[model samples]
Target: MLQKILRIPWIARRTNHNILQELGMKESQLLKNIKQLKLKYFGHVVRHNNLERLCLEGAVEGRRGRGRPRRRWTQDISDWLGFSVREASILSQDRDGFRSAVWEATSYSYKDPP
Candidate 1:
């Protein structure tokens, strides 16, 4: 779709990375934004004693199929921030600390422009 918008022909045989470089697009910007949003929402949910928080805390009652247990949403948070969900939940209580942590976590996933 971006190629179509940029009117770049396939005949040129340009790679998506090349096109993105030409356009000066930060490849990981979208991923960074998504991670930041998810983290912020996580903090919001953690701060509230609501249904969403319950679900996030894995309070759902259901039997899994006979296979490996499915990864929970909290797994991604753990992977991104290098902190266990419980620790993250505790950290989220401090808005400034959580915000700084989120920024630090997402910042490492992208490169600064030269």
Candidate 2:
């Protein structure tokens, strides 16, 4: 299921409905599990504001929001899973800020791992 999420492009919270459907998850359950996974592994909560922003920014509209939006794992999640903590740590002093920085760096096509 995680792999499936990773494979999709331009994922956002709004479009995550389909991804959750594809994974056989209810909206509430999906959000619960995502939060659980994030906290368990990253030791931090996935902010609701961030989730909303991710949905808005990452969504791929089929026809200017008329059709279902395409979903992909948020760049933050993608980079977090792909990049090492040490690399993220060196990027910013604040934990959340570092994560954001790493995500932005990777999202903008920076190839360096750190």
Candidate 3:
């Protein structure tokens, strides 16, 4: 998005970090913002927030729709952590572990925004 915003074509050979650096935007700042938002949202006790978190954690049971299952939120995070969603769910219990996992996931999948 940053590259496209700055008119940097996707075909360019520059790395994601390099493009952001040229645009005077620190990738770490974006990472920090994402972390802050995640922590704030999960820490809050609103009904909707709880529901959304539960959905992401796959705590709600329901019937399937069709063909292959859609990619899950926990799967994405677990892919970033190079592990399984079950383990990711377990780690989410610990505030610090969740943060670390997010950081790790971002560092790995930062270039490919979901």
Compute the lDDT of residue 103 as modeled in candidate 2. Answer: 43
Writing each residue's lDDT as its tens digit, candidate 2 over 1-114 gives 554546764444446666667778666555545644552334232323456445434546565655675553444454544555434333334567655544443342533222
lDDT of 1 by residue, 26-106 (tens): 767657778999999999999999989877766646866898888878899999999999999999999999999998998
1 or 3, greater by lDDT: 1
Which number leads on lDDT? Answer: 1
Give model 1's TM-score versus the native structure.
Answer: 0.71
Model 2 residue 65 CA deviation (Å) reads 35
Instruction: Quote each prediction's TM-score.
Output: 0.71, 0.23, 0.42
For model 3, residues 1-114, the per-residue Cα lDDT tens digits are 776777777678668888777778777768757755654344332224466656665554688888998886445445556667566556666767777766665554545452
Which pairs in model 2 have colliding backbones?
A: 11-71, 11-72, 12-55, 13-55
Q: What ranges in model 3 sit over 4 Å off?
A: 1-23, 26-49, 57-69, 108-114
Residue 49 CA displacement from its true place in model 2, Å: 30
What lDDT score belongs to each candidate, Candidate 1 first? 0.86, 0.47, 0.61
